[model samples]
Target chain A: MTGWLSIFKREFRAYFATPLAYVFIVIFLVLSGVFTFFVGGFYERGQADLLPFFAYLPWLYLFLIPAVAMRLWAEERKSGTLELLMTLPIGISGAVVGKFLAAWAFTAVALGLTFPLVITVNFLGSPDNGAIVSGYLGALLMAGAYLGIGAAVSATTKNQVVAFVLSVTVCFLFTVSGLEIVQAFFPDAVGKEVAKFSFLTRFNDISRGVLDLRDVIYFATLIGFWLFLNRLFLDNAREAG
Target chain B: MAPRLEARSLVKRFGPITAVDHISLKVEAGEVLGFLGPNGAGKTTTMKMLTGFLDPSEGEAYVGGVSVADDPERAKRQIGYLPEGAPAYGDMTPRGFLTFAAETRGLTGAARDAAVARAVHALSLDRVIDQTIETLSKGFRRRVGLAQAILHDPDVLILDEPTDGLDPNQKHDVRNLIDGMRKDKAIIVSTHILEEVEAVCTRVVLIDRGRIVFDGTPAEFRGRAEGAGTLRVILPADAVEDAVEQFEDLDEVSAMDRHPTPDGRVRFTLTGDDRIALINRVTGVIDGAGWPADELELDAGRLDEVFRALTSRETDHQDSNQGQEVRA
Candidate 1:
């Protein structure tokens, strides 16, 4: 546990040690506001809920989370610090989880900064605070899933650009898997199965304040699955490098 | 009672190419083992395996009697490794990086502070402790890497080319530090610089083509050359041909060469198995001939000659093997 905490602290501090954290937060906040007000027409609907903001959470995270996670292992490998980290007394799983939690926490900080939307919704009309809290929870969980995938891809290459592009492409498939346009290409049975795996369906459930146990499990398992793959890839790289 | 570091037939293969062949050795406490090799001669690969950074394709490595493959985390607790180039986080200050290293090594509270302070003072990093690593000079950066490796003060230290790219003063400082620490730890330092072997190592292991070609003390290595205990006499140029003929005819002199010196003197070098007997016989001849000699000296075996002879011989053997395949 101490090893994990040490890595987590170093990784988290590393984010703010450079301009990456500030740049990412600024871009994420500005895009979230733009998409919510102009694209989703929050005021035009005149509703007292943050559904407009939640609607664009997955798409917003598609780019933002990868930017945060791309440097997690890619930079370590490029700088040759991966060898140093791996040779430490820490276990492989501890390092992977520590790095993933750091990136997830960074994204959560960016998500937390969007509190103005919650304030605006409450001022306009009576709102279900329970749903607002669940929406934030759902967004954070989904970010963990995206970051897990990004961290795994980042471990496969030393190039941050390659990690970014590959992660975005993979996340895109997960986001749009349930859409009618995508499901149309498959048979009805296979399409339903594919939709069952889509992050959109699960994220929407939490956004609506349902808080289904199964949806929570879905995101948790997805995060665990990708992080396991990340550990395997790193371990293999140590042998093959 | 057990060796602090040991390798049993460790090997690493990448596809069809064998990077590290089956090689084994051991180092006890208070011993400095110098690992010498030519380019791509498996020095770094062997170190990587011993440090648990790379898995060997065959055999195993142990630290303090613990197998690296069986429990790498436990085995790693006993090692402090400075990988090639001394890589570190560029964005981090020396203080931040050392703290992180200390924390990961399980030091905390006052202990962590003390360790970091000790490393800083030991490497003389106080000047750049708070500066970002990328902004520091190469010497400072290398020292920072060294500080991180020694933060935990493990029983085993594996350093690959630790003095590479450092100026003379910095190199001297690093060598002093290693010398100080060798009293309680088993140290393995891989280097290409021949003089480093004489400077610090208690035993030297020379590797060629992923194999141990020579292993011995510094003096023993120098003794391997046939040119050991040669006598050289500088006579006037006019007496060169006659002196060479007379020296060659002596029973003690096995071989002799004469070359014209820049100062119009003929330099004759005589080689034989026994130095005292050979010099006595040659002096007798010289006195009888009454040759006008400017200087007389004896030569110890040169290390550079032995190193070149050993490695180049391996290359020649490989070249001829390839030639035989081409003809067949």
Candidate 2:
């Protein structure tokens, strides 16, 4: 447990020590504002809610989450620090979980910075605060899911570019699985089954003022699954090396 | 009491290639074991398995009586490993990197701070402790890696090629550090630098083709050389044949060979069992002939000769086996 906390603290502070954290946060904030006001027509809709902001988040995350998670394992492997970290008196699972949590927490900080949007919605008119809270929970959970995939893919290679591209492609499949354009190619039965796996469908439920237990479970299980894969990949690499 | 570190029939295979064949050894406290091998000779692979960075395909490595294969975390707490190239997080300062290492080793608060301080002071890293590692020089980078490895004051220290790329002075400093620490910790360091074995290692393990070719004290290794004693006399190129002819007839000289140097000087090396008699006779022969010579000396045994003799014998054995296969 101490090992995990030590790694978490170092990994978390490492993000702020470099320019990556500041640059990523600024880009995320600007893109979120642009997507909400211009692309989603927040003012025109004037529904006194952040539905437009919540709707554009998955698309924004397809790129941003990979960027944040790409360096989790890839940088360590590339710099040869992976060997040092592995030889320490810590379980592989602990390091994996510590790194994942650090990336997830950083993403949450970025998400929290969008509090002005929540404040703006409430000041404009009477809005459902409960639904807004659910939306934030749903976004954080979705970020965890995306980060999990990115971290797992990052462990497979020492190149961050490869990790980023592979994570984006995999996350895109999850994001668009339930869309009519993708599901149209399959039969009705297979399409519904594939749609059941879509992150969009689960996130949509929570975004629409409904905190479904099934959605929460889906995100939790998805995060666990990918983190497991991350640990396995790293273990294999260590042995193979 | 159990050995501080032990490898019992440890093996690591990658599909068709066995990088580390069955190898076993032990290092008790207060010993610095020099792992000597040519490139790709499984030295690093063996160290990796012993440090719990890699799982063995067969067998086990124990640290402080705990099997790394069975409980790596427990074994790792007793080890401080400096992997090849002395890798560290290049973005972090040495202070931050050592702090992290100290913390991961289970140190905290004042203990952690004191550990980091000791490491920094020991490695002379105070000047560059706060500077990011990527910006540091190669020698300083290596020292930081060393500092991290010794931060927790582990019971065992495994360093792979720790002085590989450093200048002479830096190498001297590293050797001094190892000499200072060998009193309490069991240290294993791998290098092809034969002189290093003589300099710091209390014991030597020489491996070739993923097998232990020789294992003994450094003095024992030098004693294994083919020539018990050698008399070297540097003469003019034209006089070399004359010197060899004269030395071959002497009763004390067993074998003689003339090696022409690039500087137009011919050197004859005379090997024999009796060092005192051989030296006395060789000097008499050279003095009687009145042969103009630049230098003359006698060596008990040469390490370079021993290393080459051992490693080449393995290659020769392999070649003969392959030749037989081709004929059959």
Candidate 3:
């Protein structure tokens, strides 16, 4: 109905316009199955839940979601479509938000395709469906956070590979902030504070069946901050003068 | 009536270098102003600022009387811009791209459908409407970009080199498209092609190094040439010596050159500071000498020469290199 919505529609369709969407979905489904069955040992653990499936999502998205977000602004700039898009009567924020929302929804679709996992877990045993939903919601929010960072980084350069590599590095730091290897570099107080920001730490609680209000608020704030940076970066992305 | 598109003292600076400096002009409805300049003359940068794609370091651009900086959305709504290179979504089909462009401009339902249909028809894109933009020929791709720009029929149309990179027939078709729309919208076309300016523009604004050097009608622009008012004549070989003697006696004739033709005729070019007086004197001398002139013609001046004279040549290499690097 409005500008962002139209932008959203076009960008949402753009994902499927190329092989990017199907390829991403297939890769996601295959790796998801492999990670859950072979590595996480969904069967060997004797657990009837999808915990192992959800456990490997962050790592999978660390590489995969950036692939989606890498093309968001990078391709627009590379193809010179940014000139056309920016000249339209839409707000810069609208364009940024629209593309982000499209990427988020597309990733959600891939996450939704894991319905077989949901059905498989349900058929095997009586698992806590509510916690599973919460886990799914948490995964979606975390992906959005990763996407937010990737979009901002993509806005910084027209090169998609640079966007992808930089986004992976940045996302990696955020994912590992709570690990002891990273904690050794900071003072105890700063180390504890930094640990609170880790995707692994925040997600650990939410995936365990407790949707903490603080965790949700944290993800929301992180997304907002990065998207705000994305808008700023896009404005500067136009060749100066 | 107020001009449909106007810029007031527009200036854009990338750091210390002034890309567009104190540029100002206005285009009323029914006037197609040709923005003529070389590659690095800041034509594209000015168009970008005017279209609200880039902010000016100083000054303002207005569309339908609404300031681009103050009310960009409203001003932009009245503008249809075809940016340089005619960039469009490569993955999108022409049909989808046009629909998306129309919808983004807030055209919906019947209006949107009608707009897209009209643009498709106008650009003759019916055949390629279903093809992805990347797969279409360059001409078709450019037409798709044009269709997207005109989808809303905004009051002001700013096209950056609409015919660039097209074959001659494609160039002709694109000019016809611009000509057909000239009467309804105030259009500004930036091009280095001198022939295109005469083909579609009602007026010419020549800028060089971010400054307006000449702004006038095409004839007036051409009148700036060194030999604009010169006269040329062909005399039979038997009468050439007599005509040369008579021409030298006239006070108005400042210089003259005789060129011998292979057909046993001698051609003479007469130049003077005062065109009207010189024409009168030259004719009197020819009549008095009773010279049989085979052909006599007045030179209207060469557009290429005029273009070169008005625009400085030294700015070519360095500025063009900088312009390309600055564009993307």
Candidate 4:
């Protein structure tokens, strides 16, 4: 009802007003590139898929998204700007959504700048553009999930380090749930259930050119759940202040 | 219609500590109410409740009659709040901050531009609007906070320590600025400086130990100085002792103090409600004693006296409450 477009605009531009956006984009691209070309054997694998690049994304974003999102509310709280923000006419939900979208969008821009990886894959062999698109889709959704968790953690404390550490810990749990190393400790039935909930498993399915509705729903629900938690944490902090 | 802002028995507590306790206040349109208190007197807490940043534990605050606890989003539309620290995004420039404030308040297109310009001009913020907030001086930062608080031109303005970091000249400038806004908006400016109340505030509300101890006009607050009224009496040094002794027993006289003078003129402070009546009594006492007075003067009471009288009692009262807290 209120014009949230203004909130959307301001938050979107705030990322670029400082070095935060530039630093984040440069770090994300360099690390993703390193993992894609040098570490993941992008050239040696000779695969028509973006398996090398997609494989490192969950880990890459685990750290990067938190760096981007950690200051979303934590800095606001630290600087006493949360009071200034909360007094504005816009609804809390709108501001949260706008901020989350802006951070996610910044990551998306960084992700898009990695087009050279797609180009390299195309140069070596004809890679399926459809799978590549889905890979990027899964990567973007996973980044959102990570950013949402980061936003939630950022809302909990005024310390950015604490927010970053907590976000990585949460995202790592979600990623490693599907790995045999993590699942081996559990009973067979529980292990499979945990693996089914793994972020990597759902995202891996999409990058394999499989448009599973179940995987889409998993990512969407994870994002929605974490965002809901983000809002709850913000409300608690507001009431606490 | 119902004053610009109202709080009905608002109470805010954190665990065992009560920050704001059963405080109620009203601010009418076009009136500046000076919210006066010492540190930790719940001034910030009360302002936070009014701005909907903190939910009251027991009661409601209304901005333009819209309850903050009931509908904070709606209530925020009618009120502008400058928080205690004036916390702003340090990375953003004043331009960015004001634009964000304007947009968040729902000003659009040219109206938004015009509002931003007016706020910048009103606060004399042009020099630093494009610079990051981290680079601004403390005075400029406070002005930026002021600009954001009034960017929307809301009906009610709640400023917590508005001139805290400014120099005397800047304080005078800000006082003039607040005076200019006195025609159409209700303002609540909280400060530890008692002089600001006398300078710009129409009414004074003194909070102590999370309670309103005094609420009245500046004149009434000054009138509360019973033991500190300045009095002038020009009598010979021989008659001075007799005058001090004779006049010190009046029901209104609380205490007396002599002022240093080279001439034989008697100078003393009288503790009384009516300075004129005290003066008449002193005249009568001195006239019959065959002392010819050369001059008689009655200076007004200073707010410093009122401040000390009220806050000194507050500290003693607060200490007793703290003892009760320890026992509990």
- Model 1 scores a TM of 0.88
Residue-wise lDDT of candidate 3 within B1-328, one digit each (tens)? 6679999999988887787999999899999999998778899999999999899999999888898998888888898999988999989999999999998899999999999999999889999889899999888887888888889998999999888778998899889988999898999999989988878889999988789989988867766877876889888888877787888988888899999999989999998766667778887777777877667777767888888877756546547677565432
Of the two candidates 1 and 2, the one with more favorable lDDT, higher being better, is 2
Note the residue pairs that clash in candidate 4: none
* Candidate 4 lDDT: 0.84
Quote the chain B TM-score of every prediction: 0.77, 0.77, 0.80, 0.79
Best by DockQ: 1
| Candidate 4 stretches greater than 4 Å from native | A1-3, B227-298, B317-328
Could you arrange the candidates by lDDT from highest to lowest?
2, 3, 1, 4
Worst 10 residues of 2 chain A by lDDT: A232-241
CAPRI grade, predicted model 3: medium
**Whole-model lDDT values for every prediction:** 0.89, 0.90, 0.89, 0.84
Candidate 1 overall lDDT versus native = 0.89
For A160-194, candidate 3 gives per-residue lDDT tens digits of 99999999999999999988999999999999999
DockQ of each: 0.69, 0.67, 0.66, 0.66
User: Residue A233 in model 2: shift from native, Å?
Assistant: 0.7
Error of 2 at B166 (Å): 1.5
For residue B319, model 3's alpha carbon misses the true position, in angstroms, by 15
**Candidates' chain A TM-scores:** 0.97, 0.98, 0.97, 0.96
Q: Is candidate 2 or candidate 4 better by lDDT?
A: 2
